[model samples]
Target: MSRAGSRDPALPARPRRTELALLLAALVLLALGFASAEGDIRGQLSGTVALYAGALAGAALALHTALRFLAPWADPLILPLATVLNGVGLCTIWGLHRVSDPRASEAADQLTWTLCGIALCGAALAVVPRPRMMQRYPYLTAAAGLVLLTLPMLPFVGIDAFGAQRWIGVAGFTVQPSEFAKILLVVFLAAYLSIKRDVLSLAARQLTIGSVKVFSQPRMRDLGPMTVAWGVAILLLVGTKDLGTSLLLFGVYLAMLYTATQRKSWVGIGVAMFAAGACVAWALFGHVQRRVTAWLTPFAPDTYEAEGGSFQLVQGLFALAEGGLTGTGFGQGRAADIFASDSDLILVSIGEKLGFTGLAAVVVLLFLLTERGFRAALESREIFVKLATSGFAFLLAFQVFVVLGGVTRLIPLTGMTTPFLAAGGSSLVSSWIIVGLWLRISDAARRPEPAAEHGADAATEVLRLRSG
Candidate 1:
């Protein structure tokens, strides 16, 4: 018998058990976290803690069950990591509720959104059996993405909040279409790049300076896609007045483009274009100017005291400083003092309560999740899967960087939501959907090849044919 055919089938079953075990451990940790957070908030454990734990348990188990049935070979760590991050978000929201006005509590709403996001994630898994299937409709997905991205500009339907016009009022609910649009755009980019990668990778000419081989210039035709992408990104910036989404859209495209073509010039060109766009935006838009000013001198008295200024940024800095190494503990910090503390500044809220150690842990979890995604890309055979998975991974990582950098004064605040940690329905839903897609891709990547079974049969047939 061939060595490939001699492998044990039961080995594949072991990871499934490991997945369940890890999920159970995550559930226990979450339940304890809820109880601890509630005890700290109300000065005693309450029925609300049980309710929160039960809801989280239901959502986690539903996702696990769906994965077991739909993608038995999927990467196991993705679910547990996502669940822990989501649990942390829930705990943070619940903790913040103690300091927020009773009339405006977001804890219950966030829990409801979490459950809904999990349900939608499961639905996505059930419907999309193969990640490759999505590659069939690149233009269709692009159209949907463009529509969603532009929906916030329509009169009466569009709503401006926090000085950014990125939300649309849909049937009485405010939706951030940019969040979901990002994923669709990624799908479109992956499909399009997979088809065009060879041509895009080809160098039309070489530029040499004293035999140094300074540059390999691409064909003029290949530049069309990047131009279109850049134009779309700039339009998003102008139409939405959201630097975060604008940067995210263009950055993700550049990452995917580089992944497809393995060309560094594309990234250089994309960066230069985005830099020019940002300069023009800074010159023309007051909000962009304000963001830059705040980033540069957040502590300046005039800037801090101005309306829509750096007060929130300064407060977040104070909270982080107060948190020190071991934070003030759950429900003990003045996280509510910062505007958008639960969404755009959730990391600062977490840092204030959980301290630097806890914040680092959360960042580590995000890193691991992103690492698993990149691993999926490396393991996949299909070009489309590789590009799509890498794109999604980069998107998540970049969004986190933008959010964290903004809050920490590492970069200007772009009003981006931290995935799984921020309190926003659109972001939460989109994050879970990305997890679902990752699970699908990982399953396909890890599944045992059918050719292994036929190896011995083929060997015998070849021997018989030679003897005859």
Candidate 2:
């Protein structure tokens, strides 16, 4: 008999069928959304709608099929959730393109990138069947991450756009290396911390005031990792002027550190260090000062009218206000009038067209996606898988917070793209790769234990011996 047939009847069945059902439902919804967007943009549905919908469905189904064979026990919700978000992005971008100049239309490009991303995601699953294999090359990944992080700073390659030096133009293509770098660094951190969690978790010194325990500190030697992370964050902030990435890199580091060590003091010290660095940057950098000024008084005529000031911020706020509770309905809104309506300020565009209710629904989906990552982390058996999965989850959560917080003025506007929803090939590709990693880790976590299978075989053999 097959091992699966001989196994205990009570063992949980794989949910691959459920995954297929959800994937189909998500694709159906996306098709409807694409049709609706096309109708609204052109005043009638075009045949191209069918073409786009078919392509999207085909890509999604391909990924679903890969998971069925490669990762049958993986979480079912992740692929569907990602599909919904990515489809929403495509529809939104298409709508914006129709209303804007035809010469600048990016809908085709976005679709192509989406397909490439999904293909890469499937390829990731095929290549890395085991997540633990990555743990062996922590230092190598770290070195590669540092190189990518600094690649955009090299002369003759780095290109500055929108007041930030964060992209490199090579062979007629501009790429943001930091997007890929973040994942590599996360792997490095997870691997490093998993091996050192015991040392980092144990308190080396206890601070006391009048016999009252105040705080516990990690060993001075243990501070090397934090110091390196802090210094890298500062360098990113200063060198690239990319506030969003710098904050995200350091934030994920702290999150993974705490996840591995469970040390609140480490978090406290990291935050304090970052705060000090931010203050110094504010004092020393003109761009930092300008951003702070814009955040503080966005509506002031002087700030609003100045170059690199709060014009985009105020415009995004107006778009959100116009959207109000029910939104302006897809292509009807003027969000496309604002700069970067498809990229950095996408959340505002979504809020303007989809309204607060639609925005809330999107946020809920994002939360569920992040929750699934955390769930995988909890279910995982290996420390490395847990930390790596949780780190990726934290990266997604914090990136959303930074983007939404900026658009809403809860924090200074940081030019960060919304994952899966923004029109960036680099971001989309990296996101799908992260999804593949999540699937791999979750499969390993939820797969039936080999030990149990062996025990079942032994029990069956003993019964045969007695009968004989």
Q: TM-scores of all models?
A: 0.94, 0.93
Model 2 clash tally? 0
Q: How close is candidate 2 to the true structure, as a TM-score?
A: 0.93
Please give the lDDT score for candidate 2.
0.85
CA displacement after TM-score superposition, residue 92 of candidate 2 (Å): 0.6
In model 1, residue pairs whose N, Cα or C atoms come closer than 3 Å (at least 3 residues apart or on different chains), thus clashing, are none
Off by over 4 Å in 2: 1-14, 452-468
lDDT of 1 by residue, 334-404 (tens): 78767789999999998988899989999999999999999999998888889999999999999999999
Error of 2 at 239 (Å): 0.5
lDDT of 2 at 80: 91
**TM-score, candidate number 1:** 0.94
